[model samples]
Target: MRAYLATSIGVACTAVLVLPLSLPAGALAASPAAPPSGRDAGVRTGPGAHSAAAAVPGSTESVPLRPLGSTRAPGGIAEQGVAAREVRPFSLVGVVWDDADDELRGTVQVRTRAVGSHVWSDWLEVETHNQEHGADPGTQERDSGTVRGSTAPLWVGDSDGVELRVRAAEEEDETGPVRPLLPRGLRLELVDPGEEPEALPYPPSQNSPETRPGAESGTATGAESGTATGTPVSLGTGVSPASGTMTGELAGPAAMSAEDRASSAANEGLTELGAAEIPALTKAAVAAQQPDVAAKAYAAPRPRIITRKGWGANESLREKRFGYTSTVKAAFVHHSATGNNYTCKQSPSVLRGIYRYHVKSSGWRDIGYNFAVDKCGNIYEGRAGGVAKPVLGAHTLGFNTNTTGIAVLGSYGGTNPPAAATTAVAKLTAWKLGLHGRNPRAKVTLTSGGSGKYGKGARVSLNTISGHRDGFRTDCPGSRLYGKLGTVRTSAARYQGR
Candidate 1:
């Protein structure tokens, strides 16, 4: 395949809901309450310690919520004055809520203590708008019928006890609710992220896709994720040499087999310069040197994509390998939900922060979104794998198969996402989705990969360019950015010359 210049690139829970849910007698006490039993907190575990099979590392549990407090944050500041009881050795923890119609009008934070250790890690904020947590959208997880909306998970090494607190944001509508915005149906997750079985080589011997099954939180491990009608699971892109920028495999990290490509090039006795060396030609220069190529350029409004290397993504850090899915059937848009406190120049640092958080802190293989855009609307690649490949993502639950995840960096609740950011969404969708013969404005039906909303194998109709909320029950892409979907679809259509 000739490389096109444009770039790219959970949990389980057995119906734990059926278990007896007891919130304890003290739903609201000014002082902290005693930690409840796993069953009392609505988690359905049998009596006695977990069985050896159940102890298989990285298994998950979904404990239902009761409510922490009715008091609002003093003077409206983010704080973690509350904490949950000791959980199992599941390395990851994320918060989940019930309603998509409502917003999580606050900031949530968590800290965990490693098993057998009393040391407490520093508090870290959980991405709040992540309601779409569960299985991949079109796989057996979705087809098997189990997924849900959840907060981005926090990776705390090996730990048994977890702590969580929400600093309810002051309501924009003072008349809304004098009490802080406490999201409903809160659940804490303890995931094992079981080891993945290897798959066949798509190209050279790259590592097999160790995808998690139902990672709807957009924060996940192998086989434990989804793609969205909007954007399900997502990651950051660090190495993308194919687009004439960055180092590593030309096919992007996911499909890159560096040694093989290098050997083939060496055999031909040609030294390949990086994309930076051979600059993308100017329109006039393109015509002067290669009239045929320039003529083609004028044939359509080409989407100018930024390369991962262009954004200072460090490729050396990613493992030398690639993972791929079959094809991209949909595009899910999301917001990093990491708050807006960055400049365009600081974008690289922001991406790095997210990358480390996902990999080192969250215990994910890599950052989640396939592509990420900045407030300035610059697009960066996410996850491993080629940006062009279906490379499954852990963005949306029960809907990762045959889909792509594109995330805009920053939260967009009350404040609107920059026009530049949403515009990038349109441009990215136009070029990528166009490759698959998808109409950005058209409606498509995706088989439920799995979720709390539907049965296994349920077919779902969704806009080709959808919101994160459309997948599970997330407020991702945020309310303000989500509202701009109509604009995104319209703009994408125009880019595709719809």
Candidate 2:
């Protein structure tokens, strides 16, 4: 008999009411008390107490930025940010403004104090070109009244104190220097990925999926740690020798709401309903599953990937229905731009933080990328749709319709992405692109969905494996990581026997 982790049950039980995305100015007068501020602003520190609102899977605190007066320098610049103050414990931070069409043409920087420390870290800059990575124009996800402009999130680990500043970029003219106007409704977002979900009991069965509750929040080991063989062996379990087909008593549709059932049904054949992850398969096993003989020859082994449940994703946060594209034609690589100061142990927490920020603060339908890879080479499913399907993502602004987005978790502007990370990318694209018969080394034509770099409906030719910059005029995936695309393409092609 085997007991599976009731991750699906966790989703069914943790139902949170969706809140209104934005409020008019008059509503502020009737709102709840403002968040604490100033020197005496010590906030309670705990796992579930971090959210600015009531307990949700994770939490986001959106605080308004106040003006800091003129610099009185040669540039005639103005600044805005919060003074150093204590707040609820948070690990990731980003800035957001009211308008989705607005661009934050300025420099944004932040400094933080570790949860238990008095010292503060040096100011770090947050990338401001995040508009290039989002839902395409005219789509429901993009035109939803809730969408807003945002800066790339920065992971600062667990910090209890924070201070930040946003300065308008300066321009030189005949009369000294002039600064541009900052977008209105500027607010700082502090995100806290909530504690890992607890494992609940399931009826015993020989085929029950394994559970790793403790491993979800910290460094993974054994099966959850991922082995080179790509097969995970289940370890601990409490069981009784009982056997039969899966029943409603074992947590079936009877225990889940209509919405939860819809979400689980999307991944029907990928894993057991409510399973924490989709287990890995050997290359031969993967090829055997493909019906086409030619496709079988090119199919690469499916890599081990953690599911949304495995990472404690609060399923209730996203819109009920999962969205899909016609087919996956290209793969666009990106860097999370969430900084690089995290350990493999903290990857799930970081994911949860980004998830909350994407939906709660930036006002998107869900986490933008289709999948994510960690610095340690671990792969995790992104978005709520099936891993093997062509799930439409709000990643590359104009090319999201027919392409999949894979974001490596960390900044790579100057720092090089580890060899392990790039290898994982190659392995992922080999299996994913091979499914659609795409050749990694070949060029493909993708019509633009309207981006700063390309007009809507423009036929644009791009590599099958492309950097985020290929479709948009932005420094995404970063220079260091972007420079490795040629190597990634060649390696991915080799994996597919090209």
Candidate 3:
């Protein structure tokens, strides 16, 4: 479980860096305006940090970390060393180091090239605070475990040679002296994201009780649609078979501006058509009128969950087909770790970036989070398994199994998450957990898989609805979003009829 490459980087290691420069050639920026930051989780966006690599012809030589400039920092930069046969062909790369428990000790960047080509991609910065990147200790490398401190995985299409640099930290903005620590146990990892088949479309839609439009998608809930006479009637129990107690809130959901939720009141007399017949329900599906009949007494309304099929998810990109856990007892919320620079329409592409980063770069089987929510409140299916089942996620370290990870699609550290995003979390958990008959407001004890703050097999009690930080040491789900967990939990419980 340890890929510890004991390379001796002197306390005097130094490197030159140009500030405010665009990423090196072959470098890609998801958002140019955003600054750089890191944590120990999956969905991170590479913002302001520009990356670049060497343009030298491909060789068997390994480029070493050379001294660049010293900002009164302790390190004076030395030749960390070079490579001979250590360079091999691989698609994914990672940098690992020891921090002795302090925050981001240093910065690690890498560049790669095809086996025989001289062209090199721009340098990609590895996340230094990657302590929580691995699965729980004693599990699969791609699943979870301890790797001390590591860098975020970077993907270079095809390469045989590599160059890496771990420069000292720059000066602080307060114009004070910066004494950076020379990280120990620095090494580079070359990962081969196992090959897999391209995604295949699902078999033609069938009438298998699963409807794409109404109930499953969490449309408006209340008394059923009535006949043309306006007689109040019960609709087909707007609930998933697995969910019975989810009597959702009808106010905000009910008050949904004649959009988001399709009102059954207007379609009382309309014929019930299969999801294939109507991909996206028409505006008529939403209703604005008050419930004419007695309101159902359930706690939460089943959210209109968008299945993987609805968002055009490309299943083939993942290395693993589908794996399942026993049950989902806890729901951990997280932020994509990427910046808040994308629009709802661009969510799919944003997903693509994360998917590729997780699989090809991060070296995981699929996306880490089980589900993703956009700022606009659109929920996109994550992982390949059925949402109804407990899909093991690589989101929370030491707690990936038996837990579901729902990541909002933007970094929520400094910026506040939109209200739509928060409400979506409540709607989703209400039904999903309700399927498992979980009381959202209850507390559950789960054994730590290992290597986080908790010891392996340690029974730790956690809220049924919790944040990623609640289970691990990283500031995941961010400060702002984490601050609103109380509201999310309360909303979820209310939806669950708690």
- In order of appearance, the predictions have TM-scores of 0.50, 0.78, 0.55
lDDT of 3 by residue, 1-498 (tens): 111111112211112112242333334322122321122112222321113321211111112233444433454342231232224455555554444233445566565555555455445444454556444455444423222454544434445556666666655657675656455555555543323213311232221212222233234222222122133222222222231111121222444432112211112222221110112221122212212221222323434444443444333334323455666788999876544545565555556555555553444556777888888777666775455456667778788878789988766666688887987887778656765667778899988887457888899999999887778777777788989888887777665555
Q: Quickly count the clashes in candidate 1.
A: 68
**What does the lDDT read for residue 45 in candidate 3?**
23
User: Taking the tens digit of each residue's C-alpha lDDT, what string does model 1 give over 79-129?
Assistant: 334444655555555665555334566666665555665455445566664
lDDT scores in order? 0.48, 0.69, 0.50
Model 1, residue 77: distance off in Å is 22
Residue-level error in angstroms, candidate 2, position 69: 2.9
In model 2, what is the error at residue 234, expressed in angstroms? 21
Candidate 3 TM-score versus the reference: 0.55
What stretches of model 1 exceed 4 Å from their correct place? 1-302, 312-320
What order do candidates take by TM-score, descending?
2, 3, 1
Q: Tell me the tens digit of each residue's lDDT in model 2 across 1-498.
A: 001111111121111112232322222223225653320131222211233332355566667897787663343336888766777778888899999788777788887767666566656767786479788988777876778899888788887777789998888878878776788789998887878656411111111112211112123344333343244432111111221111121123667654345444455545555666565544445555676676677666556667777667776566645667767789999998877777776788888888878877788878999899888877878987677777778889989987899999887766689887898888788778877778889999999989889999999999999999899987788788999999999888877767
Residue 217 miss distance in model 3 (angstroms): 14
The top-ranked prediction according to lDDT is: 2
